[model samples]
Target chain A: MSLDQQPIVSRNPSPAAPPAPGADAVLVARDLSVWYGSTQALRGVSIAIPRNRITALIGPSGCGKSTLLRCFNRMNDLIPGFRMEGQLGFDGDPVAGPEVDPVTLRRRVGMVFQKPNPFPKTVYHNVAWGARINGYTGDLDELVERSLRRAALWDEVKDKLNRSGLDLSGGQQQRLCIARTLAVEPEVILMDEPCSALDPISTARVEDLMEDLKAEYTIVIVTHNMQQARRVSDMTACLMLDEARGNGHRPGVLAEFSPTDVLFTTPKDPRTEAYITGRIG
Target chain B: MSRASDALYRPRRGLRRALGAGFAGLCLAATLSGVVVLVVLLGAVLVKALALPPNPPWFAVGEQLRELAAFLSRIASSTNSPNPELAGFKAGIIGSLWLLLLVALIAIPVGVGAGLYLEEYAPAGRLRRAIQTNIANLAGVPSIVYGILGLVVFSRAFGFQALALGKMLWAGALTLSLLVLPIVVIATQEALRAVPPSLRQAALALGATRWQVIRDHVLPSALPGILTGTILALSRAIGETAPLLMVGAANSILFPPSGPSDYYTALPVEIYNFATLPREEFRSVAAGGILILLGILLSMNAVAIFLRTPTGQRAASRAIAQLGRLGWSGRRAGRSRTGLASAVVVPGPGASGPDSEVAQPTDQGGAES
Candidate 1:
């Protein structure tokens, strides 16, 4: 039950990248590992996501960066038979325990997906769905307007709130999605490649939104873009997958995790160094 | 991203364009035939409707037209027919309205509820597949078959032995419910499927219970669709004489049906009775009755089509947007001028309840807004 005394994973690199001193612990994912049938996507990864800050999970394709973020509030529970060993805790409670209901936890941890999956509805209706589901019975006009405002998209989309979410350009739709999440008031926000579908300027807008939002919610982002990690993350966890001959398995691993400035400047691990230098992923 | 580069490996541009034109032409030709068929059928209905007449504009059923139009002037000016079958038509119109009410009440809830259960809760596997296939098969079954079943189960056993809502309106309502239940359920499921899973997830992420989310968000978005399907099905039920026959729909009911076992005869049954009469005068009466019947059928269909229209669906979404605004109570009370201004001032925390920690500041400067 004690997280600190749990067996140290031998394959894990040195503790040079442990949560920095004095940082607020929001989501403490300790000894987290995920398996989908015979294939293990994540192996014994531990990282501390700080409160009111962005912790970017950067990695190449097939790594379990996104998987770790899903564990924060057990979004993985939606996927059948997705088992995780070791305790990933929130505050001090188990993230995936029976006592931690997925519905309530999900409310505390909202997510914006890679593709902007807006409901096939008008912009006003799309923003309103979050509050309505929570049995909110108050002034709806104000709630809808406030959510759009927080996402910094109300001005652009305000006049056309009645228009379909689909009519907006791809960038606008993504911002709409962010507005929808803001409406929910999640304690933590998990973003899985939130800007991958956007152009560079759109990507910058989202990154700016991320910066603005982190003051109120813990943000954990999983992205393929390296420059994005340097730009937005306070802590960067670079993940990679290499052949594991001992088990004849090819599983994604966390190569190194360090503060964003340090990781991009001077990563301790060679694989981390190679990944940042664009030599090997 | 040059056009030439994008087209480099594609068939030579001119040839590709020619092939594209040919394909478009083929589709156009096929579509044209469909349009022609629709026009011809519509033309036939109008032409036949015009042939029956003794009044102004020959084909017009004066009093029936008054009822169809529901115009104050027409209702006052139109003369009533001395013909009894034509007289009984007033009763049929009333009956059809009552039937529409019954169908909507009994079928909509059952069908939509079943659909939500099947789509949102059921796992994708054998049992789900079987239920899906069963529903498909049920939808495909003829309305006449449901009529026969209604006669046996509703008229004989349940209505008689149980004495629950006897040969009354409920019996016909029951039969029609079974007849259209599959269609409503199927539409509801498709509507639910059409809603992005992200919406469901987003709601759950905001401390919403499953039922709450379903009642407020999912149901509102899906309402127009469910009603559209149920209305379409009810319109189908209105035209059904075969099923009502097995359940003992009377041929000469001078009065309108008030309840379950009143021997209800819908518009179709009324038309059928007139068409079978030996008198030549009765045939024109049937034609007039047919026009009335078409009017009722068309009205129900028009309502269904209206519900399915994009504008109608958006209208149904008003309740949901209202609920979303409720989650932010105070700032919305003050004007923000723009939807974006109001949204930014809306509180983020305590989204679960109203008056829960609104994030708004200074109620002052928004005055200009």
Candidate 2:
């Protein structure tokens, strides 16, 4: 199929808010909105996914947390009748347009979906895949070892590098997913509730892994787990629904965005407080 | 107790439930008729094969059986040498083997590759949808039509004269391969789909390219399943008759197809040829041939069943499950080359390092559609 790719070469190089830099702000989402046919899911959402830090988006069910996160990498484009209006840029390149290829965009902004999706391959092959595709030429074992180790899966999976990745435990599979993502060496990594499906032990382990991951690459995660948000993320964006059903049909909107500590301890919106305090979903 | 069991325990107060159970039992009994017929046929054939003749000769019922036994006896008992000869079934056996090889060569790769492309790489759109529907339709197209296509295309158009140099053999192989292509594609696609999409995403996320992820993870994981399905398809191709007729299979050929250009007689074709005969003895030979065909099919299936190569993940899962609650040291102790069996969930690495980890799949690499 013909994939659309157009370079927005002449984009205004200025941002509305400058994220204090340590690592570059690799991906910037400006007023992104999404629709599934006539049904709107996200409405006028803006967020800066900074590099080398884990930014967790937390909200209740039907709050458009996952939808806004998907916009950053344009994975929303995959679903038929799934449309988005607004701009998402990767490293100053516009990603939220038909002209921008999702495949190419995904290569740079690697993603780990909610489920641990280890390919039906050997553990070694799974980690080595991204490097191979991008024309990597070096010691493969070293690369595999490095990625797996980073994912905390290398020590466990080293012996059976030739074995299929599916044979791993749930936690291991999620880590394998993480390792697989690392293989591509994407600047921005999107984890869409990576630990939501795992057991408590696995969730804790994945949280630990996320903490380690933020030291290297920018991470954006969408989760319903408030505890996980507090544990793994440096910055947190809380989303909530407005009483729009009474006014007219409208999608969920972001209630507040701030540093993780500040947002959890003292949220700007009463809706955010209501959610964190278990008063309202 | 299970909710279903509890529901059943709840007294059936209505006639409708009783009627429903009766209908279910009726459906099952009806289905068993087909199953019983198959079992009975199998039992009859096996019994006939095992029951040796009680007469003095005590020979098999195949056409060349009595004569070959005589010839062997003469050579052994009389100390007289005999010219090296092959029984009729020998030619049939060789023809069948070569045809299977050719079909496997042609049908499997194209079918599985197409399956992979359709399931993995293809975008959901009009063209891909059309191709998928076309493949489904092709699977349902009459086998006789494939035979006709083979005849017109290979024999008539390409001028394939015989099976000696492998002409009829190639034609028949191509026709049979076409007949089974849709099956393989469908089987492979299903097998691939059964595999979790996370595996693909995991590989892709790991800095693996799309091809790399598919090659390293997706293809290998789906290998055993795809192979099993393809072998099933091969069995279907082996027994085909109408397609052979289309591709110029010999009526009563005495010799095996020596090359790609020779006239060949396959098992079904040989059986078909014998069954159409005027003599009662020839019909027995055909029945004997039917036994032989069953034997071949069973053995092939058995071999396929026996030759299951476990995927890395399967082995790992098994090993890991066995080592339940084991720590790193215990995991290490149980681990061999079998797989990396552990429950550790590590964070992924930053993008940097050598890219050589992704190796290409060995067997199906260039062997293509």
In terms of DockQ, which candidate is strongest? 1
- Write one digit per residue (lDDT tens) for candidate 2, span B1-369: 467667656565787788999999999999999999989996664443333333333444574456434433332222101111222354566678889999999988899989989998898899999999999999899999998787777667656554222346777888888899999999999889877765655544444456655655566667667877888888888888888876777776665667765668688877777667675445445555677787778877865564355443354433442242133223223222121212112223432122212222211122221
lDDT of 2 by residue, A1-281 (tens): 11124222223232322353454466666677888887788887766666788888888888888888777776665567898887777777787665776677777888888987766545776676577667666544566777888888777866556556777898898898888778777888888988878999988888888888877788999988898889888888888875676546568787787778988999878898999999997
Could you tell me the lDDT of residue A164 within candidate 1? 70
Return the top candidate by TM-score. 1
DockQ comparisons of all candidates to the true complex: 0.33, 0.31
Worst 10 residues of 2 chain B by lDDT: B75-84
Where model 1 places Cα greater than 4 Å from the true spot, the runs are: A2-17, A36-40, A115-187, A198-202, A205-217, A242-250, B1-88, B123-125, B158-166, B319-369
After superposition on all CA atoms, how large is the RMSD of candidate 2? 9.6
**Per-residue CA lDDT of candidate 1, range B266-337, in tens?**
666767876687765555455555666666778878887887888777665655555554554344445434
* Residue B174 miss distance in model 2 (angstroms): 2.4
* Candidate 2 local lDDT, residue B293: 80
Tens-digit lDDT track of model 1 for A1-281: 63444322332334833755456666776667898777787887776666787888987778888788877867677676788887786765567777668777777788888888787666876787676666566655678888888888988976566567888888889888888887777788889999999999999999999999878888889988899989999888888886684767667777887889999999888888888899976
- Each prediction's TM-score versus the true structure: 0.76, 0.74
